[model samples]
Structures are given as C-alpha cells and as structure tokens.
Target: MVSSSSAPGSALPGSSSPIAGPAPLSLCAREPRVPADRLVAEMVPPPRFDSVRFGTYLPDPNQPSQSEAVGVLEGFAAGLDGAPASGARRGFLGFGRSKAPKAPAGPRGVYLDGGYGVGKTHLLASLWHATPADPSRKAFGTFVELTNLVGALGFQQTVQTLSGHRLLCIDEFELDDPGDTVLVSTLLRRLVEAGVALAATSNTLPGKLGEGRFASADFLREIQGLSAHFRAVRIDGEDYRHRGLPEAPAPYSDEQVTRVAETAEGASLDSFPDLLDHLARVHPSRYGALTDGLTAVCLTGVRAVPDQSTALRLVVLADRLYDREIPVLASGLPFDRLFGEEMLRGGYRKKYFRAISRLTALARDAGRLVDA
Candidate 1:
C-alpha cells in the first residue's frame, strides 16, 4: 500500500549505481514489528473517491444493481443522525429501589455484496468520503488490513481502538481463515453493541462465507447471526473488469522474455517462489524487504496458481510492484491463462483479476523497455 512519488527505472539493480549491492537481510530474516497506529494509518489512507458520487453510478438495466445498493446506503447514512442511544434500558424498580437507565438501541448497518470488480470498493469509498469530517469518527480499510492490525495489536486493544470510531467501512469482506472469522465476528458484535454504524462491501454474502474452505458450523452460524443485524443489499451485474476492454495480445516473444531474464540474471534477481514463501512467513510490511536493492523480478514456471491463498498473495505482490512501478518478467503462461478454471470462481477471484490486470500492464512496460 506504499505510494511512490515517481516511477522506477528499467535499469538493472547494479547497472547504473556504483555502490549497489545485495541487501543486508532477506524479507524472512526477521519479523516486522509495525506499530498498530502506523499500520492502520498506512493501510487506511483516504481513498481516491472524489469523483465517485452516487449520481455517477450507472446501474445495469437487466439486473438489480448499484442503484439499489446506493439507495440503501444513502438511507443508512441519513438515519445515522437519528440513531437511538445504544445499550439504553428503561429504569427498573427492584426491592423498592430504582435502577439507573441504560442507552437505547441504534440503527443497524448495511452490507453490500456482489461479484468481483462490481465497484463495491468504489461505493464504500464514496460513502466514507461524502460523510462530514470529524476527527477519529470514521474508519475505512480492507478486511485483510484490519485483521492484520488485530493480530499485531491484540484483539481487545484493536477492538477498543476501532470501537471509538462512529462509522466503520470495510472493503473485500470475506472470511477464509477460522481465526480471522472468530476475531471479526467478535469485533463486529462489540462494535454494533457499542453503537458504531457500519458499511461494508464484500464478494461473498455473510451466509455463504467460507463455503469451500471447510469452515466450522459454529463459525458459519456466527457469521449468519452477525449478518442479521445489517441490511443486506446485493449488487448484481457482470464483472466490471471485462467491460469496454480491448482484446489481449499474444504471449511475449522469446526474445522479449529473454531480455528481461538476462537483466534479472545480471542483477541476481530473487525467485517468485522464494518471495511467496517469505510473504507467508512475515507481515505484509516486511514485503518491502523483498524490493530492497532489487530492480526487477523474473518469475518462471508460473503455469497455474491453483491455491486460493497463493493467488491472493500474488495479488498483493502485484499491487506492491505496480505501486512502485517495478518491471516484472514472467513466463510459462499467458497473463490471462495464469489462473485455472476453478480459481476463476473462487473467493479470491477479484484478487486474481487484479493481479492479472497489473501483471499485464507490467509485462507491457517490460516489452516497451525491450523494444526501446
């Protein structure tokens, strides 16, 4: 999620710089101990949603889509001011003694669920951006980032920190891990009980969470129960990823691929598998360690990434590389063919789509460098 001020160069690591040398430590050499506040801040920067107003969302004529979802979100946002006192209870007399009153219940939140690349993140970001500013009153981030924060900060402390926010807007809300499911369930329950309004976007509906992951019945039940407290809205349409896009070109020529390979070999590039292993072992903050003193990544034998977790990690890697403008060279499959049939329908489909898109752009950039 780090932002770069300029695009990275296409030169090899040690080609231009006299003092360029191997990194002192590898990404897996040590664990990253990022502070909780810093992690949250880095992960939840204000989204680029200035142009994403509700009026701009065009819905599909054939299906119930973004328009319906937008209406529900607007209503929910409007009702926030009239929300009842949370946890309020009427005073009661017991043994000729009167008990103090508690706060009343508040308005429920909204959950926007849809397929991959349906602008779920866009709408969520728009909602957060349109809300009037109040310091420490709103929180917006992807579900993965929040869960990672919870792991780093501990459950209770993370809950306390987030509960203070008046609204919580989460994107890509899907449960693949049992521990994360439990932690998120508990955290959401606490937030709702404390009267924090919520707005979230997800590819999977709450009831269908962890469908193929062999999730426990109790965990599924918890998700379903928590879902009951939110207004569920389904945004239906074709994936926006494929809309108005030109046809993809053929795979890179042998010479084009060889050019990148030679550059990497000259710079002694790291393998993608090694990077993936390191990513599995450390926090995402540690991923920066992979790019240290490195100019290019050459990945081969990438015929098909079958596992959903691996595909998701690849998505993150692609994002980091794209943000840094790093050139990547890969072989063994075309960009569009890297994903298997099953993976296209898996929970990580959106991530896979993103990875393919970014990788294609990077490949094109690399091809341009070779052509030049």
Candidate 2:
C-alpha cells in the first residue's frame, strides 16, 4: 500500500482565476496533486478540551493531515502483510558494486528528497520495522521528525535502547527553510564517522532543503557527504497515496501473499525452508534483496547473518528474533534499508506485537507451538 499523500508538481488544480502578475514562488504556490480538502482538514481546529478522545484525538499541527497520515500508516500496516508494488524501486547511489554501476559504500547523508507524499515516511517506517535484526547493531537517532530536533539529546535517548544503533531514519525531512543548517550539518558528519547509517525523507531536494539560507552551501555539502554514505532509492513515478487503501493490492497472486503470510504467521522460532525456496523462485529480479528467506542479501555480497521470516512478517520477525536473542541477517528481505539507531524503532512498533500475538494465537489454535 503506497502512501496517498503525493501532490502533482507539474500542474495546479482548483485554479479559478489566472495570475495577475509574475508566477508565484514554489512555496506559496498550490500543489497540483494534493486535494483541496486535505489542506483544509490539516488546518482544521485542534481537538477541544471537551472532546471524548482528547489525549489521543489531537493531531500534530505540523504533520500531514489525518487522511495523509492514514495513507502512510495503512500502507505501512499492509507492508506488515505483503510485498510492495513494482514501481517502488530503491535507487541506491552507493549500494551496488562498481561493476553494478551503483555506489558500493553509498552516498553520504542518504537523502530521500522528493515531492510531497509518495511514501517517504512509509519507506522510513518499513526500514525501521523490517530491516535490522540485531539489538546490538548501531543505527542513528530519529529526532522528532516533525521538529527535526535530532541533536545531542536525540542520540543520548537512542543510546539507552541498545548499543551501536547506527541507522537513523527521519520522516518528513523539511529543512529547506533554514535554522536547521548548523545543527544538521554539525551532527551529520559525526554520525557518519561513528559508522551510523543515515536515511531521511524530505519534500525538498538537498539543494532546496537549505535554499536561500546562509548555511545553504554547508547543508548541500552535508547532503552530498551523506549521499556518499548510502545509495538513494527514489520512488520517482506516481504518487502512491491511493496504493494501500482498503481494496487489497492485486498485483501479486494470493498464493504469494498466502505463502508470505504463512511465514508471518508461522512458528515464532521456525523459518520455513519452503519460504526460502519460494523466494528463490519468486523474488523479483529487482527486489531479490528484499528477503532471502531468512537472510538479508547485501549489495556488496556481505553475508551478515540470517534472522527469521524474511518473505514474511518483518515487524513480527524482528521482535521474534529479538525475543529469541538472534541477530538480523542482512542477506535478504523485502527492502534494502538502514540498520542503525533509528531503524530499531519505528511507527510499526505496535504491529510487531499484534502480528506476533495474532500468529501466536493462530499457532496455538492449530496446536503446533506452545502458548506459554
């Protein structure tokens, strides 16, 4: 399920009157793709004090609206069940080998810069929920994606969870306005040197994220440096906002979804061999690295280790592996994502428990695995 929040950049909608003067700047200009309704809903008044679901009902003023957020969340949720669409290909700048015509080490900063919507947050969430299998592995910290406040405090908070989590995924990375230049630039380099994997999504491109700011040059350099660290996979085609909405995706057959779902619902400790065989038989040529049965296939051919249930529920697989005290095998999975600090934690945190618990209940009903 792709996010349904993308706005068409080429043309504008809801145009009643022609411009009176020169063309407006991009920021003030209305986006063509996002519907007029969404913008209004986003600006809708916050929850009232007398509201029933007060604590939880309030939406973040800075984040995308409920509909857009739901688009991302639902798509993320579906990912917990099945594989992604064909159009969503990750373009790495430094992930593949020299012969592969792709970067090996990855572009520095690893920017997910692009237009609004199109699943940047979804990608970040998937990377977090599915990629890493190890608790000891290092990833970077996810500062408040809304505030972009990832500084010394963010890193410290992450250090508490486990050790060496190096992959940092920032959703809605919109720093093109300024103020974030000094902080982002200063800490980003340190993060790289510390061997942290950086992943971020933004509505603005690297050059534009810091546009017009005095720190623009430094920010650009920072982005370039970050790009050098990992490859940038751009989902440049259509806005996938309508992707995971209700009607189950029909691209792949039920057999594939069923097989993967079985792995998702299989014995907590068991990674079925049949699943690996199935992936070997069906793993898309472009996406074979997504899941190598239980192993995570690396672009550089590094045999990291095998976790469990790739080709199945990574949200579940990750937690199951953590419970079993296992390390994530970076050999094969659905996507090539970050494994550092930010990835260990994500929006799908709740799904991990739900899927595992649901699988556990099902297994007990089938009388295979023990409930206790």
Candidate 3:
C-alpha cells in the first residue's frame, strides 16, 4: 500500500510545479508473462486479505446468518485434521472404478452463498488462514485463477497438484461456461476422492450457479455433481461498502485526471477503450500482475463496455485494483454507468455488480486526491 505524503495534490520537494513530476505509466503498455511455477506459488489470498481472520470479521448484529457462517466455517476449519479418505478405488484420470465402493456420507465442504461486498471473500480467505494444515497444504484463489492453472498445466497435472492440498478455498466460484463447468466438476471429483476438503464463496447458491448465464438443462449432470460436493451456507446482508455512506464522488474531468496521473507517485494513466483492448491480449491470471506497484489508476474517456467479454475482463481488473486498495480516478461516465441494463440483468450480473461496488469504493478514496 502507498502511504500518503504531503496530502493529495501537494508538490514534491524538488518538483517546481504541482503536476511537474514524471508521467505515470500506462497500463495498456504492460504485458506480463507469468510462468506456471509462479501461478502455483501465488495461489494464496491477495494482499488486501492476507491478514484477515475469523475474529476480524464483524458480523452485523442484525444478521444472524453472518455470525452463524463464521462459527460454522471456524468449526469446519478445525475439523480438517485426520479427515478420512474416500473408500472408492482411484482409477485413470482420478475417477473411481465401476466396482469401487461409495465414499463416506457427510458434507465434504462448506459453501458461502451471498451477494457482493458482504465480506464473502474476506470470510473465504479467513478460512484459508484458519485451516490447521501448513500453507503449502492449503490453496486460495478466484475461480478464474483456478481454471487458468488448469489451462497452464494439463488437467491431470492440475488434479495431481491440488489433490495433495488438505484444503482448497475458491473465492467468487463461477459457472459461466459449459466447458469450465465440466472441467472443474471432474477435477473436484478427483480431489474429493483423494481426501481433499473444499470451500467456496459466491453470489449464487450452488444449485443455481448457471441459471441465468447458460442453458443449465444441458449441463445438469455436471452442475449437480458440482453442487453435491458442498453444503451451501447462506449469508444475508447489504453491501458493507456503501450501506450508510454517501454516494461515490462523480467522475473527474479529463484534465484533472491527467494532472493527478502525472503528479501522483507510482500511478498509471490509460484511455478506457485502449485498456479494454489491451486486456483482451493479456490473460486474466496476469491481471493481478498488471496492477502491481500501482498506487492509483486513472482512466480517461470512460464509457460503457461494448460486450460481455470486455465487461468480464474489466471486472477482473477492478478486482485486482480493489485487492490492492488502489484509488481510482477516472473521466467520463461513472462506474455505475460502465455496465448497461441488459448486461446487469444477465447471468454474470453478480460479477458486474461486484465490480461496480469495488470501483465506486476506490473512486470514493480518490475523491480525497481531488479535494486536496
């Protein structure tokens, strides 16, 4: 995190003018290359949540489910020791033989079902931290990162790598594509059979993961098989980011955004459309690296995303910026205007809503820079 020095708009010691520092870097110009080993090594929670624990989560007293979820997850983490392995005989691709016996009867994992900004990621990361096993025996990542790992390594290697982990916590669990659904379903089945525990958090319930996004009927077997591995835990609460706070500040003028981008230390300035096009070239797994060392992000000529693919990529970028708590200063349309009515109502609505929530919060943080 970047520390504040001499308030927001003040000049540096040697700089003669307020906006005279070196020009901020352009995020559109960056193309990060992440090796497979680094992907496996960086599977833990992001920096924003590295220190969160069960005690750090303050459940709204009005919502009993919030407190209940904390207790249930704490118990789940404590029970990981000496968990029994499945009795089914392992076979090729990690599936059981036709004659293999049934596995033990119990909920193999817990799922946190909730909406955006209700601390779902916070609780999911907390479980990863609270688990009794060593760091190497547990893994935490978003649904996108998990699938990217499978793509980087072959399916068999991905299963082999995670099967040894005692616990795997997936944040923002998604079922957007049919292929991803089948791939993750088969992989999880393999992990469960090998005695690995699973946990996840998402806006939709396990049973209804792809309801609005895809033809769920076509993939019912894969979807149902995915749901059976976990017991869904519902968390009810409004978005904590703006529950009682004032609305996020309006978008800044392009000139003002340019000034801040040039003046702020370790900031980046990018035109919204160019950045979107650049994102298409970079892998989603590299988005986190794309924002590394950025103290602030400034975008000019912001407008609505043109399509679902671009909107999803922007969502991933918003998540990385929020994970680092980096402030955002932008020109043109506000964050709430970034997605259209149709896109907001589609199957990936939750993901879009989450991006708006996080980006607005960061925009509010940037207001301090403008007022200085």
Candidate 4:
C-alpha cells in the first residue's frame, strides 16, 4: 500500500530527487531482481492442448474486430496530419499517416495507465515489436521492473545505447524514487525537445508514480503537460496478462463436472463468495467476472479471455461436463456466446480473423476444439 498523503518535496523509501535542481544517478534505489528460474518455468506457460474444440475462428486482419486499434491509429494519424480529433479510447493505436505530416504531433508526458491486470505490458511490447524498424529512426523499450530505475543495472549503459534512437518505448515506467523521477524527467524532457516520439507503460501515471515525493498538483501539472507531447491511448478490457499463452484447458477433476445433475440442482451452501475470493487470489487480474453458477455449480477453474486486435480468444477446458449448454445457463453475463468478433459488425470484421492463426499452436498444446 502507498501513502497517498505526504508532505511537499519528500521521497518514499529513502529516495529523493532534487525537484528543481541537479539530478544525480549515484546511489540509485535498490530494487530486488526477479528470480530467473520463475520466469523460465512459470511466467512462460507450456503449449496449448490439441484435443478440444474452441468456438468461432478469431477475426483476421482483413476484417475489423471489436477492438478499437484501427480507430486509435486513425485518430493519431489525424493528430499528426492535423485535425481536431476526439477523447481518449482504449485498445487502439494512432490512425493514418498525415499527408501534411506535422512534426508527429502527439501529447507529451502522457503516461498510459490502467489497473494492474490490464494489457499494459502486452500493448507496450506489441508496440515495440511492431514499430517500424529504421536505424535512422530509433525506437527503444525498457521494462523498469521496479518502482524506480535507481537500482536497475545498465541504466546509463542503456541510456547510451538508446540515446541516439529517435523513437523510444519504455515499458513499466513507475517512479517510486524521487531521484529516479528527476532522471526520468530529464530524459523525457530531452526526448521531447529533440522531437523524439516516445511511448511508455506504467502502473502509475508519471505524477502518481512518485506520489509520496511529488506534490499532486504540481506533479499533475508537469506530467499532464508531458502527456500533451504524446498521444495518450487507454487500453481497456480484462488484463492482457491473463489473456494469452500457449496452453490447453485440461479438466482438473472429471468427477466435479460429471456430478452435475441432468436437471438443475439446489445450492449446497453459499460457495459463490468463496469461489470469487479464490479467483481474486489465484488469477491476479481485474479482467475476470463471475457468471451465474446455476445456483449450485462451482467453477473449479477459470479461463481469461485475452483481448487482441485480431480476436478475443477465451480459455476453457476439455471436459464436456463443464459446458453449461442450457438456455437458462446463458441468462447471466455474456461469455458462452461471446465469440470475439461476433458482436462487431463492419467492413474491418473480416481481417480480424488472422489472430486465430497464432492461436493454432496454443490450442494444439493446451486445448481441444470446443464441442460443436
């Protein structure tokens, strides 16, 4: 938990920056390193299952999906091209290229932010990976991995490496240390003045990242002004962290699903709350929602629906018992019928299906096609 209330010009966790003076890199904040084994074993999941059938193929790029990526790109391109666009939207990127091409007009210091589970990392990574690679035009992305860059190694080394890149992408930019904030501020200011196109992802908006140390009003003023230099695109929906991985949904227990009655059964007790609590603890994202359990059924496992421009793929299992097929079962929230592009209707719908191609390996390794 962070202290939302703090005195002026103070730093959190013994870290402070000269708010109005020389920024120093000596004694950078010490953040712990993530165990590499965990990353190798768990962070990366195994392949998808091959046995089960998943519903409708995801929308390909030839068609538009429910996602707002195209719109974002169009709007952004308009900004660069010069036009009075609109408010911020989620899951989209900059739009068309401006024929007039005005200095790549985008808001500066605008930190792209959302809840913990949202697809901030995925979006950032995709942005970096997909960015047009032109050495003359540089693009760099760094996952801060800590509340600050104080303790992270290779900051200056990385700075030297990326300094010449015209386009920069910094992922996970949270400024927990005041000193680190000054360094970042300096970096960002220089980037802006140089007319470099910069993009970053942070759990905290630039100002709030240093909440305890920076004055909220001043922080907001500076950071928001920074945002004005870049285009602020909000990525919404459930956490992308849970969204995709090449894994199959295997039945944990066959008996659990088979025990269900042919007809509706009565409640054993109030298991819903416990189940929800379990989900909150295990899955670790804001993207999931508990649908009706038919008054008695308990969800033994869950699958996160990952949001992508191509498709909204769902996670599910191989057991037939888990399928709640009756019309009454569908009465609650939308999930079963919610095939990715089904709700979206437009000319772009056709192209979105291309996303399904990538899921092929995931399904084969971790899942069977859903029963027809």
* lDDT of candidate 3 over 240-310, digit per residue (tens): 99878988678999999988987778778889998999899988889888887788899999999999999
**What TM-score, computed on C-alpha atoms, does each candidate reach?**
0.68, 0.31, 0.84, 0.36
Best by lDDT: 3
TM-score of candidate 4 relative to the true fold: 0.36
What's the residue-level lDDT of 345 in candidate 4? 37
In order, candidate lDDTs are: 0.58, 0.32, 0.78, 0.32
Minimum summed lDDT over a 10-residue window in model 4 is located at 43-52
lDDT of 1 by residue, 1-372 (tens): 222211233333225533333221223333445566776665442323446766676676676656788887765665554343333221111111223233223335667766655666667766775554453567877677778778788888887777666578876565555576677878887776665777876544333534222122333354665665566677766655456755544455544555555544222233445656657766564454345444555554446765767767777667666545666666567778878888767655556766787677666666554555
lDDT of candidate 4 over 1-372, digit per residue (tens): 112212223343245542442221111111123332222122110111111111111212432321454345334323432311212121112323324455343352334444433434344434433434443344433333211222333345434434444356665443433565566756665445444456665433332423211222333343443644544555444323235653323332323332331222421111222333333332111111121222323222333223332122122111111222211111112232223444223222221221222222232322211221
Candidate 3 stretches with Cα past 4 Å from truth are 1-21, 84-105, 203-223
Task: Quote the lDDT for 358 in model 4.
Answer: 26
Best of the two (1, 2) by TM-score: 1
Worst 10 residues of 2 by lDDT: 295-304
Ranked by TM-score, top first? 3, 1, 4, 2
Q: Report the error of model 1 at residue 252, Å.
A: 3.7
Candidate 3, position 25, lDDT = 70
